[model samples]
Target chain A: MIAVLAVVQGDIGIAGLAASGILVAVAIAISLWRQLGLERSLLWASLRALVQLLFVGWVLQFVVDPDDPLIFSVIWLTAMIGFAAYTTSRRAPDVPRVLSLSIVAYAASAVVVLGVLFGFGIYDLEGRTLVPLAGMVVGNSLAATVLVSRQLLIAANEQRDLIEARLALGLTAKQAFQPHLRQALRTALVPQIESTKAVGIVFLPGAMVGLILAGVAPADAVKVQVSVMYLVLGSVATTTAVMSLGISRELFTPSQQLRRPTQRP
Target chain B: MSSLDAFELRGVDAGPAGSPILKAIDLTVPANGVTVLAGPSGAGKSTLLRLLNRLDDPLAGEIRWRDRPLIEWEPTDLRRQVAMVFQRAPIFPGSVIENLRVALPGVSDERAGHVLEHVGLDVDLLDHDAETLSGGEAQRMCVARALLTEPAVLLADEPTAALDRTARATVEDLGRSLADSGVAVIWVSHDTDQLRRLADHVIVLADGAVRATGHLDELDASDDQLVRRSVGAP
Candidate 1:
């Protein structure tokens, strides 16, 4: 199977490589436009994507050829987790207390999902499955955690008075943020749920297309795609729930008054 | 005790030592009437009103509520017992119902509606968003929210200063009604004519010092002596 893929890749050659580069550049441009509209960061993000991809291509040659795959997989997973933590924390620093919690939630949930799918029972920890599967879980959870943290923190700040008023009325901290918690969870999950609804008809997701191009039968490819989709849903849901709980509890003292930050704005 | 007296200010001095805002102030407010603290700009009337609610702790005096030192009460408990209506209504961002619910979460929708009606607000306005309300409507809503707490004392800082004549008259009527219901009202106003119309007891201040304290009717009558003595003397 590897020999056939290598021969086909070689025949396509420079044209295939050039096309992929163009596609990646276009993808980065679109991501920049959608995530940060008309900001100076868009140009920085484009340049960063180009450099990061080149660096990854350089590193992957050594990493993929390893006899002992565990070390490579562990390093890759750590890098992904660090990126996820940085992205989530940058979106919401008001809840700095939950920075480590969000990262841990992402890592633990990703490990469990990827472990179950490619664990000892299914197969030995093969790099092919571990790499792609872990990538999906980590990437999706990163996006979801960012959404949950940013939305919930903004909600808490905007309604600080209302939340404090409720606390004064004998409500526990959890009860004070119950409404915002629900809203944040919904915001985190809605995009994933909507994409799931539109998966096969509106768009052919990457996993299914990649499987077909790798010469798997269409029926078998569909099965793998469904399982991967379900895994992603579970990982994101867990990350958002855990992160909301961790972040919401950081705003108040046990005495219920706002721990007004000492630094003046 | 009973309905005769609400709050007692003893030696309440809320400013610097050389020039205190409320210089050695002493006043006992009866439990159920309007006490207008009137003076020109920079007078300590607003400062004295804030001291009544302990919003500004006096630098050098004691405020006693029902014979107990105000410092003895929990701040939140005291806030619930004594609410302040800011001069310019500070409408929180959200729906009108949510804004009203902040002061007293225990109030039922029915009770909120009743309080709104008492404050001369339209029933339909409750569903409107808070940020869209006019200044006068927002002030009325603020008063309604304060009423939801059923506070014993309501300190209104220029409650109708920003309102037109019609809205001002409407708010003054509501203030009179609140006072009639036996809530001790300390109304701060820059308008002396409005005080003459609404105040049962009048206290005039000059640059953070109480100049005179007497009944409004006596001050308006030939007893211009009190006003003349304290009007310009700091």
Candidate 2:
């Protein structure tokens, strides 16, 4: 099985990949039979993912140098943050200036968590180690930012009258939104918290499996995986706090009246 | 009389539409009295009540609280002195004591007992889940929470709308007692009987403008059919 997959990974590469197109065909056929109306999206998503991942793989061969870590990371991460900001904007398309807000929030959180880890020599500063670990942490935080921003906006909008009632009763905006902010952060953190709980017992996470597959010692892989889990969790919590607090500020005017974006316009 | 005014709205423009919920109309609420805001639906009574605490700022005029612009005061600070209860009261989750403590931390079990008494609720009810309270009980809890702050002015937006008649009377008596204690109570009620029982001064609003402002008899004597239509005719 190892020898067969090795040949498939090497000499039969393009042809081997082309044969997997059959899977997309089968999925589209199933969607058609079910009248799911998802055939177009399913096809586009599979093809787009294939092209994007292949392109990134080709680019990483040159950029993943152990000797030069800082330049590509700074450049690559700026681009990743741009895309993450756009992804977050989809969650709250009506929120004014959501792109800039998301960029600032996500980038600040990623930098702080990844920075401290590498800066303390807890993780090596090599390109291969820093880039991959930073990618995982930042990627996890992006999901948290989207969920936290969406939940905060919806919850705050729904509770405007009640929040205003508190504001009218002498609670500052900070105090008024404390409950809502906690609720939003909890919702965003649930995925990470559950994954952290389930990682070892229910399933081995991808990073641990990948490290083990690369011939690292199993004990060593376990330690790296634990570090990765904590990094991702810390990244998510920090990102959520920054974004939720910033977004909460925007939901009120200078006079402290709640401002809800009721429509896209 | 002007010196005693709790709030004075001058040429205020506010509301949901270009037409505004309240147009360029002026009104004053006398301090230490039950000023009933009487109007038909959509006539901006609630909008007026909200503006008193700067829940929203007026579009193009001034709202003065005790001779200073309402905006001059920090909104949270102003709201502390000018607290409000809603048409449907907000009962936060947790025990009733928790909800009170959210507003006034270190509020003693003793203080809770005392404040609940002001709203006519027994002290033992404080331990119940606030979310489990009956509609009237929840509303009174809101009132009790507001009174705990010792507000000089209380805004009640149809506080008894969801209550049974006995609950309505309990709330009305509470408002009366609040006014007697010199909290300048600005209340909005659509119920004509509630108005008669509670209003010390009546301000009639129609089409986002003040149609009449006077004692109930003076309101009855005024020729504005809009006032009689809002307050209900003899």
- Tens digits of lDDT, candidate 2, B1-234: 245456888899987646588999788777667989998998889999998888888888998987789889988788888999998888777999988987798899999889998889989999999888888888999999998888889999999998999888988998999888888889999998889888899988887888888888888777888788666658
RMSD in Å for candidate 1, one decimal?
A: 7.5
The list of candidate 1 runs beyond 4 A from truth reads A1-15, A22-79, A91-138, A143-189, A227-265, B1-79, B84-113, B121-138, B155-158, B186-234
Q: lDDT value for candidate 1?
A: 0.72
Sliding window of 10 residues with minimal summed lDDT for model 1 chain A? A1-10
Candidate 1 at residue A97, lDDT?
63
Evaluate all candidate structures by whole-model CA lDDT and list the values in order.
0.72, 0.82
Question: Which lDDT tens digits does candidate 1 get at residues A116-220?
Answer: 766645534655456667778888888788888888768766766556544433345676568778988999999999999999999998877876776766687
- Residue A44 of model 2, lDDT score: 96
Tell me the lDDT of model 2 at A162.
74
